[model samples]
Target: MAKIIEAFVDERGHLHTSPASAIVADIAAILGRVGDEGGLTSGVAALILEKRDAIEKAFADYDMLKSSGATIIDVSDRLRFQSHAE
Candidate 1:
């Protein structure tokens, strides 16, 4: 988790990574390069492409929310309940 945090931000607390949209575009590029090899059959590749399309929509929604200056709301389970679930 610490490594992930460090990857996006430097010691001075500045962004050291590309925008989320750029990362999502990279994901799309990788999906486009998928081939029927390494157990990735044509059918599996089709499914990946379909899923990537849906994921792009989600990313666009987040981008809109951020651009609108809206606060991003997320849900977190209570620690007591989380411990029990674990």
Candidate 2:
């Protein structure tokens, strides 16, 4: 009669050891390479490129609103803001 040999295992029942930090580092490296290779161009990117000027204008408008301490209005027709008080 042969004796059965049993190996101690953890809850996962796997011998592979992997840390979370290693996985994150690998993902970061892959993303860095992808970014260097011109990034992932999707429909959203195309739309942004098409309306880049409008986006820049929108950001500038928001910054102006913050600096001038103006009141913002979001109407169905358009966005209107009052100038800062003197």
Candidate 3:
């Protein structure tokens, strides 16, 4: 059987390898090429396109919470407190 992998981002804005390491590698290569051409913004745009499904799913989860009466302020405050604690 083939192993499944996952992809995640670490603190350094680079990808951490997992099952989705191939996808991450592709994004990194594109980013590197764009960066070499002094196009960081375009590189990020490319990355967003590559990870659109994951990003959309995350946003959908957030939207569900909002529909449940959670405010953006509430989420922001919690994140701020967690950041400080970290």
Q: Please tell me which predicted candidate would have the highest TM-score against the true structure.
A: 3
Q: Report lDDT (CA) for all predictions.
A: 0.55, 0.51, 0.65
**Candidate 3 lDDT for residue 54:** 100
Q: What C-alpha lDDT does candidate 1 achieve relative to the native structure?
A: 0.55
Give the lDDT of residue 27 in candidate 1. Answer: 42
- Strongest candidate by lDDT: 3
Q: What C-alpha root-mean-square deviation, in Å, does candidate 3 show against the real structure?
A: 13.1
lDDT of 3 by residue, 1-86 (tens): 98876657633555566524445455555566555565574457556767889999999999899899965666658878788788
Per-candidate TM-score against the hidden true structure:
0.33, 0.35, 0.40
Model 1 stretches astray by more than 4 angstroms: 1-47, 77-86
Compare candidates 1 and 3 on TM-score and give the better one: 3
Sort every candidate by lDDT, greatest first. Answer: 3, 1, 2
Across 33-82, the per-residue lDDT of candidate 2 in tens digits comes to 43435354333344555576999999999999988977566674242233
Minimal lDDT window, size 10, model 1: 4-13
What candidate 3 gets wrong by more than 4 Å, as runs, is 1-38, 71-76, 79-86
